[model samples]
Target: MKRIKFLYLVIGLTIFLGCSKEEITSIGQQGDYITNFDFPTIEIFAPAKVGLTNRSKNADKFLWEFSGAKTITPQGDTISYSQSEKMVPDSAFYELPGEYNVKLTTWKDGEQKEITKKIVVEKQQPVIVVPENIGVFLEVTFAARVFQFPGRPVSYEWDFGPAGTSTAANPKVTFTTEGPQLVKLTVNDGDETLSTEVVIIVQGELAKTIYFTDAFTRRIYKYKLTTQSESQVEWIGATTGYNAFGLSVKGNKLYLSETGFGTRFSAGDAAIADGVLKSYNLDGSGENIITKPVAASLDYRDDPWMHTVDRFGNIWWTCRNWGVRVINASSSEAAYPAIKFNINATIAGEGVSTYFASDIKEVGNEIWVSYAGTTGKGIYKYGYDGNYIGKFTTAIQSHAIRTFVVDQVNSHIYFATNRADAGHGLGIYRADMDGSNIISVDTHWSMNIGSGGYSDQGAAGEYVYITNMDIDVDEDGKGYLYYGYRAISDIYGSGNPPTLGPSAANSGVKRYNLDGSETASFLFKGYAPYGLAIDQVKR
Candidate 1:
């Protein structure tokens, strides 16, 4: 009788457990409800209305929560509310620029499921776009950026003080005034008008500027040529990487070269890659690395020593131990061969087969490269396409040309060289365009050539080397040549053969009238100058 009672109790317990499991499964299946929503294509600017579509299944009760949203009543009254009914109101409006959350909570069989979505409304305004620096007598374009709905047509009006006004979307305007000029833009998109104003500084008509770099400081400074004060120098910007050796100006940009991280004798892969060709705007803004050294490229081993931009917008620079390298500033290829030399060639004045190509310049339609190696020590001429044209003169073979500048207006070449023989002093000299009639330009000191502190040996020789020069010609065809004169510091080098004495005062930037007359001695002082350039408009 006890066994029968136990079996009956087990069967009863099984029946109760089975019924409870089935009931729970049915409840969970009913709770599996889906919620979905989507928005239409819209600009979603301020004062916008958004319409949402509901895609839900197996839910009887619904709740909509709009976080601090706004809406318009039946009589066009604006009201703020938080929660809404089962069906969202078509009059829901977002009148301010911000983010809002729209939520949907559904209930089925006492279980709740919710979904939240975000909406972003953008501010309605017009943005003005213009160049950072604008000059007088130069045409500049101004643009206005605005948003319009599908059927709305936007119109723009611009007002440039002293330069007149324009109704075109983007207007090309020129200002004759030199001071601060006010620019205003008004954009209308049928419903509303938004406006913005900005003040643009228009540089003077004859603002001549000179840019030069300091090797010790690794920074560039500019001085207004029109300033009559006592050398008021302004810092433009600082350089990156290592040696800031080369600088040039073309159009509205200044190009600079940093010779990587390590010394020329100790360069590794990192040092080669660190070498860069960079550019900046006239105000020292917008620093851009035009190109950098890469593996197997010409600049990989031979870093950029000196650089110049050609008429075709191609950047041509001389590599320290190799030949010339070129790159289209707009091309994707970084650094490629402009001219490569056969290092095994005989040491004769036949071609440009030198290990040291020092400086480069774009003269007329040709490119001139200077070599300072034991063999080819003069300037070699080449076409823009890298074909050999000829050499400047075999006479210059005796002097190691350090730096030179061509005065197109005066038809003369001013070069600085290191030679104390053949009547050539360790100073600046001038020659005709064909390299004839060479004469001394500046050999002011009696010790410029002989056994004084300016010896042709030791650190003193390097202190007197002119590595940077540029020419600026005015509208009257008169030109001025500017060059850096590094002074021999007391810490230059130890020993008596070469010393830094009172002649160290000869340091700073020296200016000449192109006729060899000293325009200004120590036009700028107190720093060791290296790379130099002038903001002369392209002729």
Candidate 2:
């Protein structure tokens, strides 16, 4: 009977609960706790002064009271907090990053408002700094933010891609080879790890190129000295007009001048072509034809040769039969006023024809010119305006100099004697610019006995190079002066040193000590080369 009574009580409770396993409480326990809201925020890296854009930021401070509510921070981490009178952190300074909560409260006329926000701080990633491009044997400094940040962990690793790996946070790397290199950096802060990666280009040694217009190749080419790695055998651009002869290099730009020797240049093409000066990119792109019109000089040459630019960017050029002339190449238009300088203007001798010049150079505030064949003084110094200032060297008359270049070190002129006779000519000659000390750098026998080629010469630092292309053929491509250099031999076949003929043997660029001893030699099959310009890349 007692069991039946307990069962009835259980049934009554079940009817009230209605199949739900929920606690049934009296109204006295309800509405006892206050409700709260959430406002979470997040940020990254450093400079951690985060700002909160609150709509009620302009509310009167007197109506709101501030306090830091229940704080839940990561273990062993401490955070600095600054609060305003409105109950919000003025500067969100989370020194140690982790998950935590911050609160804001507001009161107006006895009305209260409250907010609870969760703030998450992530580990700052390391920033790496290195050269985007570097040459061989160059010292590259690697830097990282992890090494500079205040209070950063001492544990860090650095990997310089294929260069090598290092335990240091900051390392200096030098590449022996050339190519793209990948770099990685990692840092640890006891609780978290941050990583960063970047790619660095360790470029190889800039190609050792001789930029020149080969009358034989009939195209301007950049011949490489190192190897087959960084060079092109044939690189031609749109014909401003074929049978062109000289190119000037400034920075990465090339200025090629076409001499309308026209039918005079080639026999089959009877059409008279106009001489044009055009500008091209280093790799031979962007042909900008420069058409500056000027009345032909009353007394001299018209076709242009190698040109030079002044500090103010003025184009000073030399012509075949004409004296030195100036053109304002600074304008963008294809036309410019050509100013012809008086050829009789001279301080040395009145008979000097300024029009007969080659290799026009502007060094400092002065302009210098080199003359070929049996013309006026071999080299002449002049004012920028073509007024002869003085004589550089006596007439380059007898030697029949094929080409001449200046020694960067002093006022010495290095000229090449182009006569075919072995004993009297076909040698390298250097003399003071003022016609003072004349010395035979390499005689005909010296060339035939060594590397049997002699055409052009260039000097840089402590070394001088000879471009050995004996000119036995005409400038029309079949010239022996093309590249008739063979190995240097003390004995020429039989008795004494006999002069070799064209097609006998040939070589390319030969490097020699200041004393004319062959230190090294680079051999090429055949080339129509003139003048050597060593371009040092400026990073």
Candidate 3:
């Protein structure tokens, strides 16, 4: 019985030992054991000294102790233990830059760990310098140097203060206008940014000669009749945009046609009369809308676009809707009363087409009007009295006509016409005062220069210069002709079925001897050199 009791006791003891072992194993699996501890160490240097204060991490509680001037006990994970209070060291120390170290201790469970880190801080920010106050002249080019901190990715932004801005590390910028400008630059570091500013004064100067091309941007430029290469020019703005036809000069005044207000359709509402005659002073100041006449009732398409100033300073213009109207400049309101005469009624022709009147010379005592049209293609000479003196057929397709010069010395009338079967190439035709002896000089030879090709005409001494469909020429008294060949494209016909291939190059003004031999060809500056007026302004 005693032996049985001993065995039972041994079994009970074994079960008790197994239960304790299982409890200890479960506790280990639950991560209750003391493992490891870690802390971050720091080092600092200022002008060259370091301070320390006790810091710890992962501890249920913290106890910080520092060695140096004072002992500090910080309760947080991080503490600044430094001897000096300044963040950066001064550069006054020429040789040795000081270094410092910081110790950090951490406790977790029953384990503890410590670490140290070193840091060095420099004094003062980087410097950027530029030359002292420099004055730059307007529109003048100059150079300058730029300085900045070394060993850094320096970014620069220059604010020229004159509204000019740039991003050049070291750049040369030119000032075109006069004013006080504030120049500034900015440099950026990964962690910080710096900027500097300078005041710059720019002086102004006079601009050179102004250029006047066609009615681009609706601005009119007037040039003085002088030979100074750099003469100053003035710009005048038009109330209504100027068309491609250009301006006409008579005496000391100028005359231009303003196709009033753009519209969407032919029968749209009249926005201040479809056509207006504008007059300007010689100095480009006293600009006045001289005439506004509703000559017709057909929605005034503003089509038959042509304007000329007669010797009496009166303006004569034609319109697709308005047959023909004459403006009396001498009148208080510049009245334009329709010309009442046989030609105005008989040939009252719709789309009166192209017409030209001389700038009023004393010879004929009557304002001679030359007109042509597609419906009834003929050149008619009308007297100022509104009487049709005579009419004659010059060419089958004489859709338009322009007077080159009415030579009172020779009683000869010179004009240009687009008379081809297709009405493309224009021809230079001449006739006597009575409309006889009409002849056509094939201006384009056999090439297609197309309509709207006739450019300009002028008289320099006895030689009369005529610009035709694709050529320019000067007619000598003895039947001698000089021609300038030019290349021109007809944009009006570009949409025809299939393409007209590329526009041919029979363009560029070419000069020819009166006998039709090629002379020197003077190329113009741009394409479609349509409105060719001699800049008699000596330059």
Better of 1 and 2 by TM-score: 2
Please identify which of the two predictions, 1 or 2, would achieve the higher lDDT against the true structure.
1
lDDT of 1 at 298: 43
Runs of candidate 1 exceeding 4 Å displacement: 1-205, 227-231, 261-274, 294-301, 331-355, 444-464, 490-506
lDDT digits (tens) for residues 1-539 of candidate 1? 11110010101011234545442111122444876556543446665666666666666666778875776677988788677654333435776657888888877768888899997766667778877567677778888766665587888889997799999987999887778888999888887888999888887544578888864556788877763223367897655554566888888888886665542333355335456788888779988877776666543346677888988888888766656778875544354444444322432354445546667899888888766554456677788767777776546646667678888778888887754535786777888787787887776533333323222322322322566798878656576788876654411332322344443344578888875656445676666666888887521
List, residue by residue over 29-73, the lDDT tens digit for candidate 3: 232333221221222122222322322222442323223212223
Task: Name the weakest run of 10 consecutive residues (lDDT summed) in model 2.
Answer: 3-12
Q: Let me know the TM-score candidate 2 reaches against the reference structure.
A: 0.68
Candidate achieving the largest lDDT: 1
Clash totals, every prediction:
0, 24, 33
lDDT of each: 0.66, 0.47, 0.39
lDDT of 3: 0.39
Q: Write the per-residue lDDT of candidate 2 for residues 263-325, one digit (tens) a residue.
A: 121223222324567677767788776653344332114555556666766677665554556
Residue 117 miss distance in model 3 (angstroms)? 99
Q: Give per-model TM-scores.
A: 0.55, 0.68, 0.41
- Against the true structure, candidate 1 has what lDDT? 0.66
